[model samples]
Target: YSLSVAYQPSDDLNLYGRYATGYRSGGFNGEMFGSNPFFEEKVNSWELGVKSNLLDGRVRANASVYGYVWEDIQTAKIETDNGTATSGLVNAGEADRWGGELELMGAVSDSMVVGFNYSYINGDFEEFPDLCGVDPTIPCLDGTANAVRSNSPGNQYSAFTDITLARLGNGEISAFINVAYSEATPENALWSNLVANDVFPRENPAQIMDQRTLVDAQIAWRDIAIGDGMLTVTLWGKNLLDDDYPNYSINFGALNFITEQYGDPATYGVDFTYEF
Candidate 1:
């Protein structure tokens, strides 16, 4: 797909808009067993919005909304394992999803910047019914015995501020910090990959709304000269709060043969590079 942004000047306002086209292969809601493959979900989208550089670019803001349609969307389908009701992938039927967003970026001073952004999304199947032996209220996924990870949220948000710390010692050092947070989204909107609250039956699935908070920082020294180039060292870390959380769920997938290796220990790494 192609995406582009343009700004023009009118007597009363600064006009801004974005034009783009994109396509995605139908996301597989369940797994494909043996040699039998399934169909995919596809979408076509279009959108437009505007922004204003009010107060001489000191205060800038923008807003936009978009809509899309999916054809023959993949929905809940069934699979059998060893002549038994096992896990598998199926079309979610057909559907449509649409949403809109708003944002504002303002500069209160040469050293300070503030911003805010929000979005709302809504997606649903036009003809999604329960598969045989499955409940519409449960999410049916592949693997993990029975996991109910399904339909996700369409709402999102953000707000932030940044300050450029004044340079220090020969006016060469710079430092900055950022903070962000958001709402939890179910795997999608179905509360399950195929059906709401239903699991794939290879693993144990839980009803969870995935959301979390994060804070990060950086302190570095730069410009110390080596024999041939500048030497710079940076100390950085993520999820620094050491908050315990699930990074992702395993649904057997293509790696189902490796179930015995599921609960591996956490990881830590270190590196040193010299540019010459």
Candidate 2:
């Protein structure tokens, strides 16, 4: 269920708020035999935000903040038995999350526009009691510790711009560029290698993903008339900087080894489209 309200205090400004409830059905962990089925999960969330236009709509800005309380949160983990490992999910208890975002865009000229966006988020386990250590031989049932939510980055930032470069025979040439960054975060929610220092044991370094920055861009020519239709051609590139970063990993401590998968390298391509 959800409820939302909005108000416009002026011709160029507006404010809004929302409240919502969410639910997820319970399910069994097919990978682990004799494991009890997890219970359903629920959450309550809310948000408040505002939007504004300045300089006669040439510049625009928006911001928002939100929070949520989650119960019986379902989390994924690796289950080991008799030297074998299987992936499965479990209900890890409660969590509290909050975040906000800011966006700004401006028309610097009739032919060019620039924009920037930033977002931040945080999540903490409020009642997780089944955390596990890096030792695959040790099961979660053997310990009680809190761990950060998996894949939840605390901050992200991006900036992008679009520009009209020129006017050619019945067509327009334009270009766009975007740069983005993400903060490092844990890849697994339950395994933190806490057996060593229980108080402040280091996380499984192999399971913590590294922060990364990526850039993508494209240039295109559009609106060339072709048999009563329009044609567009574009050239694009992704991960322009060719950043090297590990996106996923698994730690097999008993074997004294770990495995990792990396993000993609720089790549380029061309696209063609026609409309009638």
Candidate 3:
């Protein structure tokens, strides 16, 4: 169930609030032999926000703050017996999360526009008692420790600009560029514990996703008349700075190894399109 309300105080400004309830069905853990089924999860959320158009509609800005109560959160973990590892899902427990975001965009002139966005989030286990530590021999169900929520980054930011570079014969040349940054995140229970200092002496850095900044840009010429059609040509690049960072990882505790996958390297390409 969900409810939301919005009030427009002026032609250019609005305020809103919302509340929602969510549910997820339970499922069995197929990977762990004879493993019990994990129960469903639930969440209750609330949010308040505002939106505005400023400077005669040349600029726009929006901001929001939100909180959530998550119950019976389903999480996955690896279990090892006699050096053989198996992964399965479990209902780790409840958690609380709060976050906020801000977005701003404005037209500096008739041919140029710029925008920025930022978000922050903090989440912690509210009732996670059965959390495993670095030792694989200790059964997760038998352990009692608080852990941070997995895959939750504390902060992120991005900025971009669009510019009309020139006017060509029957066409316009434009360019766009964007840069994004993400804070490091934990992968699972053990990794989360390391971040919370529940487990001392960091075992391996591979268990945590690394923070990184990436840049991407593209330029295009559009509306060129070509025999019975309009053509567009574009050149683009991604990860322009070639920043290296781990995007995903898996920790095999008893196996004493962690596997990681990295973000893509710098890439460049060209695109062509035609419209009749």
Q: Give TM-scores for every candidate, taking all chains together and pairing residue i with residue i.
A: 0.63, 0.88, 0.88
Q: What is the lDDT of residue 93 in candidate 2?
A: 80
For each candidate in the order shown, give its overall lDDT on alpha carbons: 0.51, 0.82, 0.81
Of 2 and 3, the candidate ranking higher by lDDT? 2
Give model 1 RMSD, 1 decimal: 7.3
By lDDT, is 1 or 2 better?
Answer: 2
The C-alpha stretches of model 2 lying farther than 4 A from their native spots are 131-145, 192-206
Top-lDDT structure, candidate number: 2
**Model 3 TM-score relative to the real fold:** 0.88
lDDT of 3 by residue, 1-276 (tens): 999999998999999999999999998876534758889999999999999999999999999999999998887656555556677777767888999999999999999999999999987787764544556664554222446556777999999999999998799999999999999888765532133223332333226777889999999999999999999999999999999888778876435677889989999999999999
Cα lDDT of model 1 by residue, 194-255, tens digit: 32233432232332445655555554555656677666555555555554544334333323
Distance from true position, residue 55, model 2, in Å?
1.2
- Pairs in clash, predicted candidate 3: none
Write model 2 residue lDDT over 1-276, tens digit each, in one string.
999999999999999999999999998867544566888999999999999999999999999999999998887655455556566667878889999999999999999999999999987788875554556565554223446667878999999999999999889999999999999987777653333323332334338888999999999999999998999999999999999988988775543567789999999999999999
Comparison by TM-score, 1 against 3, better one:
3
Of candidate 3, the 10-residue stretch with the lowest lDDT total is: 192-201
